[model samples]
Each structure stands twice: as structure tokens, then as C-alpha cells.
Target: MAELRLEELTAQTIVAARNLALKPGQAAFIAPETYVHVEQDLDPAGSWPRVVMDGDHLVGYVMGAFDADATEDFLKAALWRVHVEADAQGAGVGRFAVQALADEARRRGFDRLTVVWASGEAGPEEFFKAVGFEVVGETPYGENLGALAL
Candidate 1:
């Protein structure tokens, strides 16, 4: 297995992160543009956006939140968005990235990590479940809400 790492998203990596592309049929799950827009809108105090790296190569991107003061309905440490590049999917990159996010949440004193994905999407529900998340509920927008107790 390759060593998977998460690097803090910085000005130097933003362009590469924004250029990551999802596989066919996967775009409905999340958009790269959303990651860029969210990164722009949320101050560093409210979000931690990271570039997923395999060795020195940028392979994906993920955004998470640790802000206990967040006014949004999501109170726990949540994985706001994650996307593995089209070429890197199914090589355990997604698994490693989620596990890394969970580890980060644990480091922040969080006991759980929450994520929401489009319920109607094909792959995400199974991918999340395979990584130890359980379907807990549905978001008001009908997304599948899941939790992993770290």
C-alpha cells in the first residue's frame, strides 16, 4: 500500500486541488468547484481544507470542520466534502483519506465524525459504509447522513 498523507491546503496547492477530476458517473456526488467555493467562503477558523497526497502527488481533496461555534445544524466535527481524482479511485485512496479525516477528528477531541452525501448517488453510500460509517438519518435536503464513532 502507498503511504497516504493529508497536507493542509495552501495557496501553493489550491490550483492543483481545484483541478482534481472525478470519475464518470461520480460528478453527482460532489463537485470540485464546490470545494473551491467553500474554501473561499469559510474562514480558516471554521474549516480545514486539505489536499490528499500519495507520497508527493496530489490525488484528491477533502474539507472538514472543527468549529464548535458553527451556527450550522452540523454540530459535530464533520467531513464537509471529499473527492478523489478520477485516475486514483478504487486504489484505497478514498478509504485512506476518510480514515485520515477520522484521525484528525479524534485528535481534535471529537468522538464522532459526520458526513452527508446525496442519497440517490450510486457509490458514496457504499463507500462510506465500507469505511465504518453507519446511516444515521437523512438531511432535510434528503441527503444520506452518516456517522462514524471515532
Candidate 2:
């Protein structure tokens, strides 16, 4: 394993973060339609976006949104997006990224962090659960709502 560190997503790293690869059948679980149903309504002010670096190489991206007043549970201190390169999957990149996000949430006075996933083969349901998020409920759109207590 290379040295893993989290960096604030900056202009210089934006392209690399956006280009992070995913395993086959993982595209359908990405934001704007599937797992992250809260993407369109996210407030930029509360967004905490970060990139995971493994010795100068971009390996993953994790985005969290913090909104204390969000009516939907998943929108508050939410796990907005997480994308890890296919080759790096299951090697702790995603877990490292999410732990950073959860730390940020704790700093912002949140007692928990929430995430939703589109359930199906190849979806990220197992990873989210393994990271300590329990299925709290289901979204109206049928996404699994998971909460990780901070």
C-alpha cells in the first residue's frame, strides 16, 4: 500500500478526481440518478469534497454534505459521492475516504452521517454497511438509507 492521505479537492486535482475509475457495473450506482439521489439538491456551502491520494496518485473521491436543517435524514451530513478506481477497490481507499468525511461531520456537530444506495448487484451497499452505516430506512425512491453514528 502506498502512503494514503486526504486532500481538499482543488482545481489541480478536480480532473483526476472526476476521472477516478469504477469497477464494471458500478456506473449505475453513481450520483445524479442512482445512489446519491440528494445530489441535485445539495447546498454548496455545506458540501465537503475531498480526494484520496496514494503517494501522489488519485485513487478515490468522497463527498459529504452537511445540512442541519435538511428535512430528509440522508441529506444532513450525508455521504454524497464516493468513487474509487476499479483497481483500488477493496484495498481500503474507500474506507479511508469515508472515515475522513465522518471526522468532518463530527467537527460540524453531527452525531451521525447518512448515505443512500441503489440496491442491486454491483451496488455499493455492502461497502457502506461494512463502513458502519446501518440501514435506517428506505427512501421514497427506494434507495437504502444508511446511517453511521459519529
Against the reference, the lDDT scores of all candidates come to: 0.76, 0.85
Q: Which candidate achieves the best lDDT against the true structure? A: 2
Give the distance in Å from residue 93's predicted Cα in candidate 1 to where it truly belongs: 0.9
* Candidate 1 per-residue C-alpha lDDT over 67-115 given as tens digits, one digit per residue, 9 for 90 to 100: 6655544445888778888889889888888888889889988888987
Q: What is the lDDT of residue 120 in candidate 2?
A: 89
Model 2 residue 130 lDDT score: 91
Residue by residue across 1-150, what tens digits does model 2's lDDT show?
A: 787998897898999888877888898887635434446777789988888988978999888888898877678888888999998898998899999999999999999998878888999999998999999987788778889999
Q: Where is the poorest 10-residue window by lDDT in model 1?
A: 31-40
Q: Which stretches of candidate 1 lie over 4 Å from their true place?
A: 31-44, 71-73, 121-123
Per-model TM-score on C-alpha atoms: 0.83, 0.93
